[model samples]
Structures are given as structure tokens and as C-alpha cells.
Target: MGGVNTVNGMTGIIMLVLWALAFGATAFALIHALRQRSDAFTAVDKLTKPIWSGILAVALLLLLLSFGGLGLLAFISIIATGIYLADVRPKVDEVQRGPRW
Candidate 1:
């Protein structure tokens, strides 16, 4: 029926939005990490690495689970972004900070 089709369409749109959000979060994290240039930022990144890694791992797992479900690549991309955010960014921040005060 027309109503059924409409519902399905809405569901698809919702899924797409969720996927985009996940990807966006990852990208934002990466950018922030790359741009960070402060001791406080570095400290926060160090403190949050493990937690971020765990979050990224879970995100990756969900993405894998979504292989044939919805937005799998988006999920993966986000995971990659999270990796940069959690792992690479902290190191970069530390380097930028240079020697301790």
C-alpha cells in the first residue's frame, strides 16, 4: 500500500541520518585532534584514548554487523575517523605541546 511504502521510505531516511551522524562524529573528532595545539587538549586526549578506542572498536563491530543492513561503509569510515581521533590525535597533540612547562 502507499502508506506501507511511505513508512519504509521514512525508515530508510532515518537510517541514513544515523549513518551520517556517526560518520560526521568521527570526522569531527579527527579534525579536532589534528588541529589541537594545547597542553590541556593533549592531556584530555591521553586520558580519553582508551575510552575512545573502546568506543571505536564497538563502532567498528556494529559496522561489521551492518554489512548487509544499512550504512556499513559509513560506520566503517566513522570507525577510522575515531581511530585518528583516539590514537593519532593524542600523539599529534603531544608533539605540538612540546616539552613540559
Candidate 2:
């Protein structure tokens, strides 16, 4: 019984860590997205800056909805943030470079 309790406690801790990491990653993307120029998004052929901001906002909302702690809502947050970082961030960087050599 003690061993079972320990395992359950460890699982909760792991979930907490995962949630924190996911939230941190989403916040990072949101800030970086905000600091970028609106025109840069167009040049990169990604969604407009306002739209991406909305997406990030929704991701944040999902995170909040996960107040019960990492669940389906939390996974949605991670997926939303992951999309922005993986698909959009690189494009934004390229556009900001203004025709790099």
C-alpha cells in the first residue's frame, strides 16, 4: 500500500513538471510572437500577427482550463504552442532577416 501511494505521488509530481514546462514554452512563444513585426508574418506567409496572437491566447486559455491539472485541455495547449514554435517561429525569423546572404 505504501509503495502504491509513493508511485501515485511521483506521478502527480511528474505531471506538475510537465505542465510547467508546457506553460513555459507557450509563454515564451507568445512573447516572442508579440515582439515581432506584423509585416514579418506576412512576408513569411504565416497567419497574420493578430491571428497568431489569438491562437496563443486560446492556448493560454486552454492552459487555464487545465486548472484540474494536466489533462486533455493541457495537451491541447501543448499542441497549439508546439505548432507555433515548430511551424511559425522559423518562418518569422527568416522574414525578419530581410534577405539574408
Candidate 3:
């Protein structure tokens, strides 16, 4: 029983960390998407600015309602956030800032 409680506690902590990270990441992506020029996304050949903004907004909303658990909604939210950060962000930044030599 004590071991089970310990395991549950650890799981709870992990879930909380995941939840915070997901929320923060989604928020950051949304803010970044909003800050960039709409043309930058087009220049990068990515989704339109409004579409990305809407996606990140929905991801953030899902994260907020995930109850600190890594449910399907949370998983989807994290995936969307990851895509924005990993794939879209770099290309958008490059379009705005130019390539690094």
C-alpha cells in the first residue's frame, strides 16, 4: 500500500510537470505566431497566420482542461505545440530574420 502510494505520488508529480510544460509551450507558440508578420508564414510556405494562431489557441485550451493528465487531448495539444515550435517556428524566424551565415 505504501509503495503504491509512492508510485501514485510520483505519477502525479510527472503529470503536473507535463501539464505545466504543455500549457507554457502552447502559450509561447501562440504568442510567437501572433507576433510575426502574416507574410512571414506565407514566405516560409507554412499555414496562414490566423490558422496557426487558431491551432495554438485550441491547443492551449485543451491543455488547460486536461486536468494535469496526459490524456488524448493533452497528447494532441502537445503534438500541435511541438509542431509549431520545432517545424514552423524555425522557418518563420528564418523568413523574418534571414538565414544565418
Best candidate, lDDT:
3
For each candidate, the alpha-carbon lDDT, in order, equals: 0.60, 0.88, 0.92
For residues 1-101, what per-residue lDDT tens digits would candidate 1 score against the true structure? 99999999988888867766665565466446434554544455454544544555556556555643456555565757666666667576667667788
lDDT tens digits, residue span 1-101, model 2: 99999999999988888888888898899998999999999987889999999889889889877854788888888898999999999989987876766
Each candidate's TM vs. the true structure?
A: 0.44, 0.92, 0.95
Off by over 4 Å in 1: 37-69, 82-101
Better of 2 and 3 by lDDT: 3
On a 0 to 100 scale, what is the lDDT of residue 57 in model 2?
Answer: 84
Q: Number of clashes in model 3? A: 0
lDDT of 3 by residue, 1-101 (tens): 89999999999999899799889888999999999999999998899999999999999888878878989999999999999999999999988898789
The weakest ten consecutive residues by lDDT in model 1 span 33-42
Residue 30 C-alpha lDDT in model 2: 93
Candidate 3 deviant stretches above 4 angstroms: none
When summed lDDT is taken over every stretch of 10 residues in candidate 3, the lowest stretch is: 61-70
